[model samples]
Target: MGKALIEKGQIYRNEEAWELFSNLITEITPSKVFVIADENTNKHCLPYFLKKINFEKSPEIITIPAGEIEKNISTCLKVWEILSDKGADRTSLIINLGGGVVTDLGGFVASTFKRGLRFINVPTSLLAMVDASVGGKNGVDLGHIKNQIGVINLPEMVILDTAFLETLPSEHITSGLAEMLKHGIIQSEAYWKRIKNINRENKVELNTLIWDSIEIKKAIVAKDPFEKNLRKTLNYGHTLGHAIESYFLENPNKKTLLHGESVAAGIILATYISKDLYGFPENKLQDISESMFKHFPKQTFSKKDIEAIINLLIFDKKNRNGKVLFVLLEDIGRHKTDCVVSNKLIFRAFEYYKNF
Candidate 1:
């Protein structure tokens, strides 16, 4: 008999991730395959992947609109309908292809379809590969809330292809960079140094960096798969980052913030507050902000708008009881989790961003 294969049943990463995916799928050989993607990934990523993989059969391709706004029950229902029409059954498999939005919605769709089915993630963006691709955490945004509804269904495999990143716009590339920066802050100084030097003009080296970021996430998630402990540290920039994203999502007239852009702003605000309240030091905060300024330009928000965003944060899923908890920085590569900050400090965070 062939040697017994050991399946860790968790996330995997490498430059050859796509090749690994092709091999794994060939071994499993599901009856039917579904490839879920957003409009952007369909145009730039899916065609290349189809040509590379030796699928037992041609997979049904389903595409959804690309953006946070499209991540909802409406889209989820459409994906379900597509799976139904394609005769998707328990024996079928789903391969989610795209950014965080695609993985989030596609995972939700796969988890709920006929109770559940095995799915794989071929995360194409840096943000998705680093953060969203690792955790079993999957969900869709609610009205104004980001990731309000979700499930925890780990993928059968995750294919991390940096080749797809070559097609990403500079803005999208920088957006994903914010998450990498966040991961470095929360995980390792060595990683932070590696990321601090990445430039918008450098496109050939993203594949290696993306894998490093994914490895950071894997170490954290493997230790706290359900997000009950150290995993909360991953929210380093997301507390305020999520609020920023929702605020822009609500106000159509204002410039829309990409997931990483909002997080970049969130990191700046959080670090400033960390200095003000937690003795993190003003110099450290300034250094972080200055580095981020290279990629994310400072966005102006009115005091009223800032307060409104904080108000929405009160309803965040991360909050315990009525108080909103912040993952504050002590310094880069270090964070204090579940630290409760007062409205005064929260307002101060906004004040800092105003000047920043």
Candidate 2:
């Protein structure tokens, strides 16, 4: 079994965590229980879950598409409609049983239905487990800008099973690891070193590392739940990263960038900016870049494409008062926020990182 961090909700890890889920819900005896998952999790994981927890009363399962595109108002509307059709009452409990998309969108749905209801998160992806699941950042993407419409509402509990990692492909695993790396760079070098080689294959031994990321997030969230202050540090690589994700999202010929892929790019660009603006060591920047490249392949984005991506930052959710406030690094594990830059500079930063 793994450890548990009980904050906004409890996050439980290890193979035995499923047993805890059964114990907690059986005691509550919710009028109706609903588990929301994406297609990927439903196919790869639901069987194991059903075998573990023989629900005295069968729970409703809702599955949606398994990509960032699906995290939108249309999807939320569909979920709300599904719950209404299922006769879900105020007493119903929602279990978000997939990765970041499911947890974020499902949490938003639960929070809005009947004002609010109990919801648990069964984060099957490392990205969701370490970052999205811990923070009360429930939302759906709007157009190209990511997570544009959302609310902050904590889950009742979070279940993290390292065994689930075995089923994910390398790409999916890489996505989650990017967030873990971000967590390390933002707050804990020890955590970063702990997860330096964490991929799907080596996840079994990274349980403590996973919890360490969660703890870093917990500390950040506890200090700034509403994102009124230090919480911005969590967006370290997100400013330009979100824009890249958005830019490719609308292009038919170009492949879509996964949340973590865009974030990896975001961090790289931010690191470059940190070096240029803050005298961050060149060796440190190279180390950070090399670490990301080893895990995530660099995409060949053209100059035009880079410029287009930079333009999308205007729509980033973090921008306030027409200023693109970015979270930057002074060094690994040390983050600062409230730095604003021009659109041209954003383009140049992308170009610099793309080449460096």
Candidate 3:
């Protein structure tokens, strides 16, 4: 069993993860257990999850539609109603079992229902395991704005079993790789070097890398749980990435992007901006661009799309006053937080991403 400790939660990995989860269930011994999953997880992951542990009472399973589109207050209202109707009290435990969407929305639901309820996260996707589920930042998007309504509430524990990845689509796996790469770029040059040659076929290596990413994030969050300073570095690529995600989500013409896909593009754009402003090495920029493009297919953006994405920047959580703040890097492992970036630079960054 692999374990990592966060401020208010514990993370367990692999076979030992199940052992820890069973122990946690025995300890909590809540009045009831509620498992919240998206449709895909309900169909694919729930059975395996049920088989692994014995529950004194059969847990109630709540299934939401599987997608980012379903992560909103309307869904939360329905879920809250279900919890209330099912006679859930503060003693009930919520087990969020799925990817980022499920965990994010489920955590929000659990946190808001009757003030608060104990919850555990069982992150099934790479994105959720390394980033979303670990951080305790749970919330749903407001309309097209991403993660606009949420709270930072730690779960009792987080269970990560790579076995769930087998049920994910290839694109989703690639999507999660984006966050792991961000971890390397923002915190560890050594990790960056190791991740540059990632081989998904080698399960052992991939799992090890995933754990390293989680540790990097865990260390950062421990230092700055509230994103007062150091934790802001974790938003390195997300500022613009989220805007692009929201724009695509609202637009009818473009195919919606996965969270990691948009972040992959945002990372490349931020690298370019960093090079322009901070004298980040040109050679390293080239290498980074090549690496990102190799994993994520280049996304074509029109002038209109770029403008719309930029306009959405006002909704970024990191914004201060009216200025847009970005997390820029002088080099891998050297990051600048809350730095103001101009529209002209942003346009240039998009151009750089488009032509790269």
Candidate 4:
């Protein structure tokens, strides 16, 4: 059996996650406890979370429709209604069980309802486990712009169990792996080498990789929790990636892109920008571009599509002024944050991605 452990705010391994949940609910002793799941997690993970850990009050369960599209004020209103009707007070505890959408939406609801309520995160997907679940960043998108409305508030605890990945599809795993690669690109050469060579079929190896990712994230958040500077490196590919994700999400005629799939493209474009602007090594740029293409093959973007995606960057919450900003690399494992890129420069980067 894999060992169960707790460090910082993370409860590692499902067995320990169960123990940690059982203990936390008991110790906090809230007037009520609630578990929030999307329709997918309600079907896939909620039963297991319920059976593995017993709750003192049977815990009220709330379900939202699954998908990023459901993340909005409408959903938050519904959650608020449920909490108000259920008599959940300031001392209530909410456990968010699912992927990025569920945790992001749930965290926002718990933090805003009754002014504030304690909450825990039980991330059931790779994206949530590595990035969304820990950062205390919670919010929903505003139309084609991602994370337009949210708060920076930490959860009471987070439970991570790779077992959740058993039922996760390969495409989803690949999506999350994009973020893992971003972690490596921003911080460590060794991590990048290990990640690019990973056998996704190897569960043991994947688990270790996930643990390393969480540790890297933890270190970054501890030093720059508010995203004042260093934590911005985490946004390496997100500025353009989010625009791409949102564009596909809005355009039904095109193939819908997953967040990671979009990020993979964004990373490539950003890498090109890094090469052009920051003197990043051309050989390494070519190598990473090939590696990224292995997981995320090049996608054809029409001039119109590129135009819309670039327009969407203006709404990026990271923007300090009206200028569009990006987190770019000085080199792999070395990045500079808050660099403004011109529209013509961005267009050229996209062109490079397409032709390469």
Compare the candidates by TM-score and give the number of the best one. Answer: 3
Model 2 agreement with the true structure over 1-356: per-residue lDDT tens digits: 22242334767766556677777676668899998999999999888777877778989999999888899999989889999999999989998988889999999999999899889988888788888888788998887678888899988778887767777787887898888888878776676666666644454466767787788888988888888878888888888888888888888888998889989988888988888777777887888898888888787788788778777777866678977788887778777678876666666777777677
Please list the C-alpha lDDT of all candidates, in the order they appear: 0.82, 0.82, 0.91, 0.87
Estimate the TM-score of every prediction: 0.94, 0.93, 0.97, 0.96
Q: Deviation in angstroms for 113 in model 1?
A: 0.7
- Local error of candidate 3 at residue 66 (angstroms): 0.9
Task: List runs of model 2 lying over 4 Å from the truth.
Answer: 1-8, 197-200
TM-score of 2: 0.93
| Cα deviation of 203, candidate 3, in Å | 0.5
What TM-score would you give candidate 4 relative to the actual structure?
0.96
Judging by lDDT, tell me the better candidate of 1 and 3.
3
User: Cα deviation of 144 in candidate 1 (Å)?
Assistant: 2.1
lDDT of 2 at 291: 88
lDDT of 3 by residue, 1-356 (tens): 22232324768777777787887777668999999999999998999999987898899999999999999999999999999999999899999999999999999999999999999999999999999977789999999899999999999888889999999999999999999999988876788889989999999999999999999999999889999999999998899999999999999998999999999999998999999999888898898899898999888899999999999999999888988899999988998888888889999999888887
Worst 10 residues of 4 by lDDT: 1-10
Better of 1 and 3 by TM-score: 3
How do the residues 40-135 of candidate 4 rate in per-residue lDDT, one tens digit apiece? 889988877788887766989999998889989998999999999999998888989999999999999988997889888989999999899767
lDDT of 1 by residue, 141-210 (tens): 8986899899988888777667777878878888989988888777766877778787646655566777
Tell me the deviation in Å of residue 287 in model 2. 0.8
Better of 2 and 4 by lDDT: 4
